[model samples]
Target: MNGASALEVIEAHDGTIDLMVTDVIMPEMDGPTLAKEVLKTNPSLPIIFVSGYTEDRFKDEIGDNAHFLPKPFTLQLLAEKVKEVLS
Candidate 1:
């Protein structure tokens, strides 16, 4: 979804979210900050970050909970990373 507000992400989803696949850079917010806040509500949530930058690009922003899926990944690659994270 194209998020409209800075913190309006909570209302963007239907509330039974299983996974959050977000870009590292967006017009509203970056992925890692969003993930941290999203976890406050769903502690068991899984996040997959996508970006063209290197793994070290946002390593300082993300904690141990989220997984990284570098940009330009194939659907299969993204799926595999998600499966690996969920597993």
Candidate 2:
């Protein structure tokens, strides 16, 4: 889903959100911006950013709880990263 919809879902849900996986480039809002907003409410939430852009481009913008997954990654890699972050 797009950032706005994702934000809405986060706001509406009462259950815990284990992780947030978002693309760096998205319509309406970028992933980093979305992460910042999400953190305001869920500061401890973990985020995984998947993007075609180089990691250096946005690495500093996201905090320690966030991970960057460069695009063209395999599903296995994604799963592993998620597991790593959640662990």
Candidate 3:
């Protein structure tokens, strides 16, 4: 799930997913594409993106409901993001 394209991972899901945390600058089908496609099937799933890049640079790709974490984030921040998405 980590390195695979978001769509590949998403298509593999079988309704057990509650949240998806992905790196924004992936090789294929960036995080946004993955999340967007997943949302088409499961709109309620929470998505959190972690990237070293700026959000504005990827604004057009990310979904409106997606939360973001800038690069160099701490474990606490990641945990907080996950909690926030789930909550």
Candidate 4:
């Protein structure tokens, strides 16, 4: 989903959001910016950022609750990262 729509869903949800996996580059808003907005309401929410770009570019912007998954990653790698973050 797009950033705005995702934000709406996030805000409307009554239950917990275990994780948010968003693309680093999106049409409506960048992933970091979206994460910042989401964190305002859900500070402890886990986030896994997926991007084709280098991780160094956005490393400083994310918190310990976040993880970076570079593009071309296998489904196994993504699952591992998600499990790692959720754990």
**Candidate 2 least-lDDT 10 residues:** 57-66
In model 3, the worst 10-residue window by lDDT is 1-10
Q: Write one digit per residue (lDDT tens) for candidate 2, span 6-72.
A: 8888899999899999998888878888999999988888899999989888788776667889998
| Candidate that would win on lDDT | 2
Which tens-of-lDDT digit does each residue in 1-87 have in candidate 3? 544555776688676888878888777566777777778888988888888989999877885767889999999988888887787
Query: Total clashes, candidate 1?
Result: 0
Sort order, lDDT high to low: 2, 4, 3, 1
Better of 2 and 3 by lDDT: 2
Clashing pairs in 4: none
Name the best candidate (by TM-score). Answer: 2
Clashing residue pairs in candidate 3 are none
2, model 2: CA deviation in Å?
1.7
Report how far off residue 45 is in candidate 3 (Å).
Answer: 0.9
Kindly list the per-residue Cα lDDT of model 4 for residues 1-87, writing each as its tens digit. 788888888889999888999998887877888999999988888899999988888787765557899998999999999999888
After superposition, candidate 3 runs with Cα above 4 Å error? 1-6
- Flag regions of model 1 displaced more than 4 Å: 1-9, 12-15
**For candidate 2, what is the TM-score?**
0.91
On TM-score, who's better, 2 or 4? 2
